[model samples]
Target: MVEKRATQRHRVFKGGTITFENSGIACTVRNMSEGGAAIDLDTTITLPQSFTLLIERDNFVRSCRTVWRSDRRIGLAFVQ
Candidate 1:
C-alpha cells in the first residue's frame, strides 16, 4: 500500500479516552504520529464523527475525526 500519512507513526499501547458531547468511551492508543493515530476501542457502538482523544500517560489531548473503522479499531485524523 502507498504511504499516505503526513507523519510516521510510532507503535504504542497506551490507554486513552474518546469524549464528545458529554459522552466518553474507553480506547487504547495503538499507534501515533504528529498528524493522526490508530486506536482500539472497547466497543463497536457508533461514535460521533468528531471527538477528543485524551491519553493521560502521554499528556496528549487532540481533537479528532473518524478516518476509518474496522471491528473495534478506528483510524483518526487530528483536527487542526
Candidate 2:
C-alpha cells in the first residue's frame, strides 16, 4: 500500500532531542515544515503512541507531537 502524505514539505535539517514516557533519546531533524517533521532516532528507541519532541533549531525551541512512527524513525507535527 502506498502511503499518502501532504506534499507541502520543506527541506530543512535541524538537530534535536526526543523524550518519551520511559526514556529520552537523541534524534536529528532530517527535514521539516510548518506542518510536520521527519526525525532520525536510534533503532533501539521505541517511539511511544504519543510523545513530545523538543526541537532546538537556530535559537528557536519548539515542541511538537509524535503523530506517526516506524521502526527507527518518527513523524512529528506541530501541536498548536
Candidate 3:
C-alpha cells in the first residue's frame, strides 16, 4: 500500500469534541499528525465545512476542515 498523506500519523485513543457555533459532538481521536487527524464518532453525522476540534486532556484546540468521511469516521486537516 502507498501512503498518501503529507505527514505521518500516529495512533491515538483520546476523547475529543467537534464544535461549531453552539453545537458539539463527542468523538474519539483515532490517529493524528502535525497536519491532520482521524476521528471516530458514535454515528454518522453532518458537520459544517469547518469547525474546531478540542482535545481537553491535551489542551489542544485547532480549527479544521473535513477532508473525508466514512460510516462513523472523519478525516480532518488542520487549518493554518
Candidate 4:
C-alpha cells in the first residue's frame, strides 16, 4: 500500500475532549502526527466546521477541522 501522509503518525490511546462553544464530547486519540490525528468519538453528534481538540494530559490543544468520518471515528487536521 502507498503511504499518502505528509508526516508519520504514531499510534496513541489517550483521552481527550472535543469542544465547540460550551459543548464538549469525550474521544480517544487513535494515532497522531504533527499535522493531524485520528480520533474515536463516543457519539456521532454534529460538530462545528472548526473546533478545539484538547488533550489535557498531553497539554495539547489545537484548532482542527474534520477531514473524514466513518462510524464513530473521525479524522482531524490541525489548523495552523
Candidate 5:
C-alpha cells in the first residue's frame, strides 16, 4: 500500500500515558511523525471524533488531536 503522509516518521517507540474524557489509560506510542502518531493501548478505548492528546517527552510537551481510532489503537494529528 502507498503511504500518503507529508511528514517523515521516527521508528522510536516511546512510553506515554493517555488521558481520555471518560478515563485515563497507559499507552505506548508506536511511531511518530511531525504531523501525527499511532498509539497502542492496553484495551479498547473509544475515542471521540476529536480529542486532545497531551504528549510529554522529557522536558518537552506537545498536544495533538485525535483523527481516527480503532479497536485498540488511535491516530492523532498535530493541531494547527
Candidate 6:
C-alpha cells in the first residue's frame, strides 16, 4: 500500500476528547502526527463534520475535520 499521509504518525495511546456544540465524547488517540491523528471511540456514533480535538496530557487542542471513519475508529485532518 502507498503511504498517503502528509506526515508520519507515531503510535501512541493517549486520552482525547472530541468536543462540539457544548458536548464532548471520550476517545483514544491511536496514532498521531503534526498534521493529523487517528482516534478510537467507545461506540459507533455520528459526529459533526468538524470538531475540536483535545489531548490534555500534551496540552494539545486543534480543530479537526473527519477524513474517514469505520466502526469505532475515525481519521482526522487538522484544520488550519
Winner of 3 and 4 under TM-score: 3
Model 6 TM-score, 2 decimals: 0.96
lDDT scores for all predictions? 0.92, 0.70, 0.96, 0.94, 0.72, 0.96
- Please provide the root mean square deviation of candidate 6 (C-alpha atoms, Å): 0.6
In candidate 2, position 11 carries an lDDT of 71
Model 5 lDDT at residue 27: 78
State model 2's lDDT.
0.70
Off by over 4 Å in 4: none
Residues 1-80 of candidate 2 have per-residue lDDT tens digits of 77555656677667777766666678888877777788887665655555667665565445577777777777887666
Candidate 4: tens digits of C-alpha lDDT, residues 2-78: 98889999999999999999988999999999999999988788888999999999899999999999999999999
Per-prediction backbone clash count: 0, 0, 0, 0, 0, 0
lDDT of 6 by residue, 1-80 (tens): 99999999999999999999999999999999999999999999999899999999999999999999989999999999
Clash-forming residue pairs, model 1: none
Question: For residue 42, what is the lDDT in candidate 2?
Answer: 61
Give lDDT tens digits, candidate 3, residues 1-80: 99899999999999999999898999999999999999999988889999999999999999999999988999999999
**What range of 10 consecutive residues in model 2 has the weakest lDDT sum?**
54-63
TM, every model: 0.93, 0.66, 0.96, 0.94, 0.74, 0.96
lDDT of 1: 0.92
RMSD of each: 1.0, 3.0, 0.7, 1.0, 2.4, 0.6
lDDT winner, 1 or 4: 4
Q: Clashing residue pairs, candidate 4? A: none
* Ranking of models by lDDT: 3, 6, 4, 1, 5, 2
Report lDDT (Cα) of residue 28, candidate 1. Answer: 92
TM-score of 4: 0.94
Q: In terms of TM-score, which candidate is stronger, 2 or 3?
A: 3
